[model samples]
Target: MNKDVLTFGVEEEFFVVDRDGHLSPAGDAVVDAADEEEGELQQELTRSQAESATGICTARDEAERQLTALRTDLAEAAARRGCRLLPSGSAPLAETVLPAITPNPRYERMSEHFGATARTSHTCGCHVHIAVPDRETGIRVIDHVRPFLPALLTVTANSAICDGYDTGYASWRYQQWNRWPSAGAPPLFGSLDHYESIVDAWLRAGAILDRAMVYWDVRLSEKQPTVEFRLGDVAATVGDAVLYGVLIRGLVGTILASEARPPKLSNEVLRAQIWRASREGLSGRCPHFRTGDLAPASEVLDDVVTFAAGALAETGDLDFVRDGCARLAAEGGGADRQRARFEKRRAAEDVVDLLAVRPARD
Candidate 1:
């Protein structure tokens, strides 16, 4: 992989909702109807969610175009099926019934094995895949990027409300997602062998059904030659999604170019930091993963931008990242926006309406 200009891709999961913002079982229909020329849409684990994967992207503008086009096409297809595309992490309104599992054999097996964990697993997330030449490099990148995962999650936190009530968390989806035994931040690995050993243990212990169930927030992709960062919620807009992809690419590039050892945060501290980030998002303080000092979330975000400065400059993404940070500062992150909308009417549906990504009409 080129350290300066590594190729990356983004996959975003979205909720399929009706006009009233209720979860709809039209995900398969939407995926089937969406135009695949821009990006690929696939069925998620649940019938209420659809996932879109962008083709390999080398430039910021290319990624933005593909993501925007995919969302637009998905929105149009959902409209034809009498549904809307909700880009939030979790369904704001309480489900009258449990979400239906997608009609795939793997999904069926998951439901059979995990029961409630599978039935209630309807959260959406944004995954960024940065190309790596080999698994060793990918493992190194994951290790180096571990400390910053909380900050990245904070910026993209969008699940403030769930089950028609305030969960008092910027990312309720994260809380729900961590119920899976295999989910959450991955352990720092000494080498590729160390990473595989942990996976081997999980398999032997029956903690995960397969390698694909290695649901760590960061991992080497089983199907792609990339380090996948699965830390953030599905962004609330195409711009937010693009910003996340570029930041991950820059961070991976920065890690690949440097030989410095990243901070070794303990598992307890790492879990605490992730919890704090999910609770506060960008509106409150974040614990510095290196020092455990509390700092404003915005300050931590600026620190991340500074940390990736060299790679961002080399890739000509400095301006875009700067502009995105400024926009988030002015308008707030996804969680903040969701809260603001909910406050207007004190209604969960209002939050859903605010997050619905609709297509332009003629």
Candidate 2:
């Protein structure tokens, strides 16, 4: 395989809601009902959620097709069970009762150990996996990709509403997710050994249960030769998910081919940038990683696209990415679109209704 052209996949999480837009514990039923030839649908941390993952794909169209099929399958299955699949970062309305944890031994252990963090957590996210040759290259890509994560989060923020009220943040899921001790932005590592050393310390200190529990925004995949970006909320549409996946692949390809050193950013500033991205999405200013100066979010996004131009062009995804960015700019990020729907009807359920419909193929 060419190092500059990589295979990629996307995983998206969705909430199962009843026709009334209330959280439903139909995750297992939905997974069983959905067709899985295109992609896999599985039970998530909460019984109210289901997660879908595409198979390895070499191009943007391939990934998009799989994601669209998976979403359609999940939606149809949910409808059959009198529930709807809501693709959003956070639940727009509060559940009358706490969501039940999925009945799995690992999940049960997580709930027992993490307590409320595990129990009250029902947020959804989009994770992109890009293949690398080995662990060292994955680590290098993870380090280089660190500076762009906040911008990626901004573009993909979809969790504006939560618990029956406007959370005043684009991706409320980002906030909810960071409550995990091991979650959030990872440190820049000097080498693969350095990365493993930190993981060793965290495991020994009981910060994480195992290698799979390394919940950083970006990390090396434990089960694959890929770097997984756990940065953004589950996108609102199939187009949005494809846009994210292509951008990530482009960024990784660019990073792999370039000999440029990663930037040295302070942990404090990086966290603040992430907080801003989650809070504002594309509606407000984003801190430029190079200068630590705030700029319009759109400008920050442009910077990322410009940086990945060569790779995107090589993969024939440049046009797709450009068009997607334009749409996001005009219509706003997922969170912005959700709030628009809510403002029209002043009902949280309206947001659910808006998200439940799958977008038609272009």
Candidate 3:
């Protein structure tokens, strides 16, 4: 196997809603109904949600095909239970009773340790796993991608409301997930040993019960030879998810080729950048990691494209990535579309309805 191969996959979480489009705690039933060959459809932290992960793929088109099929399978499964699968990041309305946690020992420990953080945390996210041959390369790629996460969040933002009201933030899921003790931007790791040492310390300190709880926005995957990006909200459409996956691959490829030294910035700075992104999405400015200047989100995203040009060309994804981004910008991403629906109809459910349905291609 080529050590530099950028094989990747996407794991998406979705909420199960009833016929009326309200949250339903029927994930287990839906999962049972799903076809086994559609890849891993696992129980999430909440009974209201289920997650599907595609098999490792090398081509953007292959990933898209797998994701579209998996989503269709999930939708069919949910329909069997008389529920709709909603692809947004957070529930539009608050549940009177928090959804039940998956019946697993780890989740039970999380509930006991984290209390409300675990109970009220029903938000979903899209995690991208890109293979790295070794931990050293994984650490390097993670450091390079840290500054770009906020912009990526802007492109993928989908959580436009919470508790039946506008949250005013594009991706409210980020705010919810940030409350986790080990969540948000990770501090730079000098090497794999440094990363493992910190993980060990967190476990020993009771900050997290296990390696799985190291929920940084980006982290070295404990179960695979990959660096996982857990930043973006679960994209509301298959197109957006594919775009994110390609962009991530491009970024990693760029970093590996350049071999640039990681920028030295405080975690405080990165967290603030992430907060700004969660608040503003693409309509606002983004902080430059090295220059200490705020740039328009579009410009920042363009820089990402420029940085990834070589990789995109090598993978024959340049045109696909460029066109997809243009379409996303024209369609205003998921959050923008959600807000537009809400403004037009003055109903939060309308936003959910738009997200639940398959999106028309641009």
Q: Which candidate is the best by TM-score?
A: 1
Q: Where does the lowest 10-residue lDDT sum fall in candidate 3?
A: 353-362
In model 3, where do residues sit more than 4 Å from their true spots?
A: 1-4, 357-362
Model 1 residue 228 CA deviation (Å) reads 0.3
> What are the per-residue Cα lDDT tens digits for candidate 2 across 192-252?
9999999999999988888999999999999888999998999998899999999989999
Candidate 3 has an lDDT of 0.84
Query: Pairing residues by index, what is the TM-score of model 3?
Result: 0.95
Residues forming the 10-long window of minimal summed lDDT in candidate 1: 1-10
Residue 312 displacement in candidate 3 (angstroms): 0.8
When sorted by TM-score, best at the front, the candidate numbers are 1, 2, 3
Query: Which tens-of-lDDT digit does each residue in 28-48 have in candidate 1?
Result: 889999886877889999889
lDDT tens digits, residue span 331-354, model 3:
677888888888886788887778
lDDT of each: 0.89, 0.89, 0.84
Which sections of candidate 2 miss by over 4 Å? 1-4, 358-362
TM agreement with the true structure for every prediction:
0.97, 0.97, 0.95
User: Higher-lDDT candidate among 1 and 3?
Assistant: 1
Cα deviation of 92 in candidate 1 (Å)? 0.4
